[model samples]
Target chain A: MKPINEMKLEFVSKSSNESFARATVSAFIAQLDPTIAELADIKTAISEAVTNCIVHAYKSSIGKIYITVQIFENGKSIIKIRDKGCGINNIKQAMEPLFTTGGDERAGLGFAVMQSFMDKVRVSSKPNKGTSITLEKNIIPRFIKNGQPS
Target chain B: MDVKIKLTGNTLTACIEGDIDHHNAKEIRECIDQKIEEESPNLLELDFSKVQFMDSSGIGLIMGRYKLMHILDGKLQVINIPENIKKLIKLAGLASLNIIKE
Candidate 1:
């Protein structure tokens, strides 16, 4: 599928990079002129996916996190976060609310938050192979033009 | 992210600035926990007035602190949370867990 706009970024799997990754994607999506709420949803969703890569996928080991964002006309976006690390053995269990491998430190709400904020969320993983999460959102402009809701 | 704590009598309020994610959630938790441990306030207030963004990690941070405060016989209050973040806190069913002051 051809994308109207696309960007790809690769960085080391470090916790500190989570904010950077989020900001980059948000900035890129700014061209779509999304509302503050819409943008926050996107950023929060991105943060969860990248955080999973750093905390669960690599598991204290250094690895690479690849993020690809594609924006299509008609206010739609597709975000893919991939990590080449220890993969999930049970995607079903992992997606369960309050089910987390990261112990008490994790709220186990990452996938839930993603699902709530985005239109669609898909996770594909294989043990020892890696995990890839795809998130899609349709950003409807919430602004008004000419003193009327557009 | 920046965390600033203030104490008034038995109330300890920590004002968190910037986005709350996995990157800074640990730090936020550690710093706030240390303050709570030292002061043992009757009420721990998290001021999100300056916070612009947050995710599940933020929710986790609040839940963990709620547990800590509960053990110490204290209550947790969330103040000035932005609209979007406030919606998320409610979506996570945290409204039943803490005091969310609009």
Candidate 2:
């Protein structure tokens, strides 16, 4: 297996810091030659994951979010978001759509949306030990009219 | 974020500006819900004309509004959805909600 190109970013769990994380991922993935829609999907997934950390994991408790991204030579990209805050007790229930632990205002579709946009999403949480989310996608190869990959 | 509210008869229009990601979605939900409850409008129009970006959080806001308006026997229409947002809305299979573009 070819070694993947990796980039790491760490930031505080601040609402305003979400953009910085998104930008960092975007910049790193831009090297992979993703399409516009693919880029949008990546950004959206990152936003959802980071937002979940800020709103749920941290829950007003100060913490840090560590994001690690790896781009494989085969155009496969993997994003790992880890948070050292309160962990989820029921990962399965939390992934259910519209099942929010929050008040009536939260739609609780964070995990669902992330699943929709990414090719693969996996979440692992240990009670009081924190949670980590891994998102992966394969960039579709562009082909020219001559039947050669672009 | 910029929020514009317009009243036409019993209908209320909310023009949202800027990004509607997780960071600001809760605030948007509260603001819109409060206005809807206060005015008790028979129709609500959400204008995404000026909205540059939105993620799943935006979808949650729209869905919540749909449920809210449904309980009141009112209607919700999304208008001027940007291309990117339109793609997302379609991806979410929410085009059936009667989102119109200008």
Query: What does the lDDT read for residue A112 in candidate 2?
Result: 81
In candidate 1, the residue pairs with backbone N, CA or C atoms under 3 Å apart (3 or more residues apart, or in different chains) clash, namely: none
**Candidate 2 collision pairs:** none
In order of listing, the candidates' clash counts read: 0, 0
Give the top-scoring candidate (lDDT). 1
After superposition, the stretches of candidate 2 with alpha carbons farther than 4 Å from their true spots are A144-147, B33-39, B71-73, B86-102
lDDT of 1: 0.90
Distance from true location, Cα of B97 in model 2, Å: 5.8
lDDT tens digits, residue span B1-102, model 2: 778898899999999999888778778878888899899999999999999778878887888899899999999989888877766686666877665445
Error of 2 at A145 (Å): 9.8
Which candidate number would show the highest TM-score if scored against the true structure? 1
Query: Could you say which candidate leads in DockQ?
Result: 1
**CAPRI quality band, candidate 2:** medium
